[model samples]
Target chain A: MVVSVAHLGPPGTYAEAAALAYVNWLNQRGQQGLLCPCPSIAQTLRAAAQGQADVAVVPVENSVEGSVTTTLDTLWQLDKLQIQQAHVLPISHALLSRAETLEEIKTVYSHPQALAQCQGWLERFLPSVQLVPMNATTEALKYLGEDKTAAAIASSRAAQLYHLPILVCPINDYPDNYTRFWVLSLQPSGGGSHTSLAFSVPANVPGALVKPLEVFASRGINLSRIESRPTKRSLGDYLFFTDLEADAREASVQSALKELTAYTETLKIFGSYSIVSIGKL
Target chain B: MVVSVAHLGPPGTYAEAAALAYVNWLNQRGQQGLLCPCPSIAQTLRAAAQGQADVAVVPVENSVEGSVTTTLDTLWQLDKLQIQQAHVLPISHALLSRAETLEEIKTVYSHPQALAQCQGWLERFLPSVQLVPMNATTEALKYLGEDKTAAAIASSRAAQLYHLPILVCPINDYPDNYTRFWVLSLQPSGGGSHTSLAFSVPANVPGALVKPLEVFASRGINLSRIESRPTKRSLGDYLFFTDLEADAREASVQSALKELTAYTETLKIFGSYSIVSIGKL
Candidate 1:
């Protein structure tokens, strides 16, 4: 089967790198595929849900940045799309510049996420420099080619794509910066045994969270994540997003989900997909 | 006693709004005052630890977004700074423009966080327009004065500061959008009766999380937030950031912290402060 992957932005984003990695993985296994790029996570999920793409790859969380709200919110909102597999990509930032020397660099450019990730490094290395922020790291790279004094904090791959030289590599404050991405698709393939769901509990109820969680604990289903986002309609009301080891189709998981619905004001099963192993970089 | 409050930007940002709310609260109670505006969360905490600020206000989590990793990481890294009090400030976004009509809006500008928060509203309201992302919403508002077709997504206060007219108000997708901010001080006087800490567990150990969490459960300490950020050193290693009731000086909490240290690879207390009321706008 051909799998079409969707990612954020044009061609040189970290999302694109992840999508390419997934494509290469499929190709190495002798699987045929097409990787379709989308401008945003929402568009990518929409494409996958509408069968325009068989599977979509989007960033769900960042090790140094916590959860990507857009991805999580989209997963909660999109009823047809389900997470099939997850991948964690190690991220090493690079300072790219069109100019050859540090003396010539004046303005530094990058996506805010990239800029924030390398905050300490930038303060230490380029304290007096003018930091110019942009929409995407690729855009910064693109603009660097036009403005000689400008540098960009982007993936090393982005530097190469824009024909810019890396002034410094591994520029992030934390050496272990990584981004977690998830594969979303319409089909619930039970072969990949993982599921994600979103739900809300009644406000002011004591042990409201514990009761739903106990359902998973009793069933021996390992919960990978449990996060709460404010429901945004009232004070103290929260929507909980959770990841579990068993697929929603499994008897135990289904029973747990059913029991959870009784305790929760609202429950949504996002998707169930077999876990995908991240092959070597 | 004097309190030092820290926020995100120079003078304008949501963090500033929340900090001001905190300051107003202190003023109403006739407390001594100091406001420290740090460029980032790390700087804010550093100022607190270094005794530059009596207390600092930093964004920890948001209703739409889950957690701010910078705040979480700074808490993890800093040995002295602690969370004294937590407050939730309601966020209302506005579309500020120099031009009067939607037809004149050729570009929209905002901070990445603000832009992401208003994504659904922007897609629905201005689908055909170009998005001109900026470093801060205040910067966007500043630029709007120079460009006729540009509108900025920022707070009403920003519009007032920049002397721009509000074309639209409360444009966020979530009507109940709020941001959770923690006040950090070197000495724990104003924070009253709560403590926050960061802890890490051994890699590849199943149920390693349950033990420390059980301390809270067993003691009925009431956990407010629990977040996992990858260690980045190892593939599966993670650091958990949690907030619980009771000050560090409290017998039960101190005992739990002592018990928790034996069970985890690392345990650090961020701060203890009095809990603040979740403000209504």
Candidate 2:
């Protein structure tokens, strides 16, 4: 029997590295895992939903960047898929190129997030070079194959995969840059100390959000995050995505959620998930 | 005296339109206003800070998409800039091109935000067309002159400025899409009813944010928005940006802020300003 994990990829992206890391973790637990690379975060979610992959790994939030909207929006839109586990990967970007010298580079390309992470570095070191953002950082590897003048900001794993030379390691502006990826599966894996959920409240009511949060605070459920995304209906109307320290199986948590559901116009549990702190593979 | 307004531009962007609208508003008040086109949001803000422009108008939020991080980050970095006024404009994207028909478009270009806003439309109408994201939607205006196969998702104003035909109107996924732009100036504008502020609380303390809100609630001050971004120090650390219904000069708001500043490690008052809403020109 084989287990398949889907992730955003052209084979060398951080998402792909995360998928490899998950596979490594699964292997330690006596499971044989196969990696399935998808083009977009939306497709990565769909791969798991459609059973092309048993699970999907997609970035949820970044320590530096905040929420990954593509992942968050897709998770919200796809009602059936549930988060099985959460993984934190320290994002250490590198300047990858075929060129021997930085002065020879005319264009630098990577994922927009990657480009943004290295904005300060690119500005300081390669001020005159063009910055092009692609779908995935791995896609930048392809551009450098023919153009010696082109460089890319990507993971060391991307450099290794594409057989490119690393001009500079850890090109990210902040050393503390880290990304949290959520492992998603069609069914709930269960047995997790943490639970993630989203809910929307009536817009017109003042202190509408405070009430639902009070339900958690009253239960002493420590919330790790509370991110508000626009409902797309109007300005100021939002859907709050929250992370709690307890799973639905806990009686106190269940009661709090019941009270929360009553207060919210819409509520969703993204399933219980444990955090996996792993280094990039 | 000519008062200059700076905005993000290639000349046909929403930001440029907002600048023109602001100039119109200023002209109505009998002030001679000059339009200044900037290459980026950072440049636009810098223009005001360096006295290159009297004020700068840049998009801060979208109704459907939410906060503009570039605007938020730049504002946070430039502590001297103050909000003169907030402007909300209806965002209606159109498919603009030299091509007579949608079928003739082999590639679609837009700003990443614009692309995301029209994702559903592009997927439905031109599924296989290559989607390219540029710095501004207006940059796509130049591409049409060279490539008959290229189309851009931008405003009707952009289409007119570029002398291109609108292939599709209101291509955005949501009709409720509106962008809120902030008019920024070096000097604080006095006597506005609305205020915007940001603060960061100690990470170790649970319910730290709750105390700051309680200050507002206790004073009966209405908060319109609360957005949290990563502090970039570590995971779970955040800086909260908030919007209030009352100006800092108001007795109630001042008292609440005084209490809020004491509770948080860092607090910044972005100044009090009223909102000026105008339809997209």
Strongest candidate by lDDT:
2
**Local accuracy of candidate 1 as per-residue lDDT tens digits, B1-281:** 77766666756688888788788888999986666677666787788778877777888877776677777777676777656677878888999887878888888888777888888888887998878777667777667766878888989888777688889898998887888788776664443466777788754333456667777777777776667776656444568777676677788887888898888898877767765656564
DockQ of 1: 0.36
The candidate maximizing TM-score is: 2
| Most DockQ-accurate candidate | 2
- Superposed Cα deviation of residue A71, candidate 2 (Å): 1.3
The reply for model 1, stretches above 4 Å from the true place, is A1-3, A28-31, A202-206, A212-221, A245-265, A270-281, B1-4, B29-34, B189-193, B245-255, B278-281
Writing each residue's lDDT as its tens digit, candidate 2 over B1-281 gives: 88899999878899988888888888899989888898778889988989988999999889888889878877887888999998888889999887887888899888889999998888899988988778789887777885779998989988887788998898899998889999989886775878999888866344666778778866777778888888878888888898888888988887788777778998988999998889652
Clashing pairs in 2: none
Docking category of candidate 2: medium
TM-score (chain B) of candidate 1? 0.90
**For model 2, how does the per-residue alpha-carbon lDDT over A1-281 read when each residue is reduced to its tens digit?**
67999999878888987888899988999999998888789899989988889999999988877888878778888888888888899999999998889999999988888888888888899988978777788887888886789998888888887898999898899898889999999887665978999988866454666778778877677878888898888887888898888887999988998888778999988999789998652
Output the lDDT of residue A132, model 2. Answer: 79
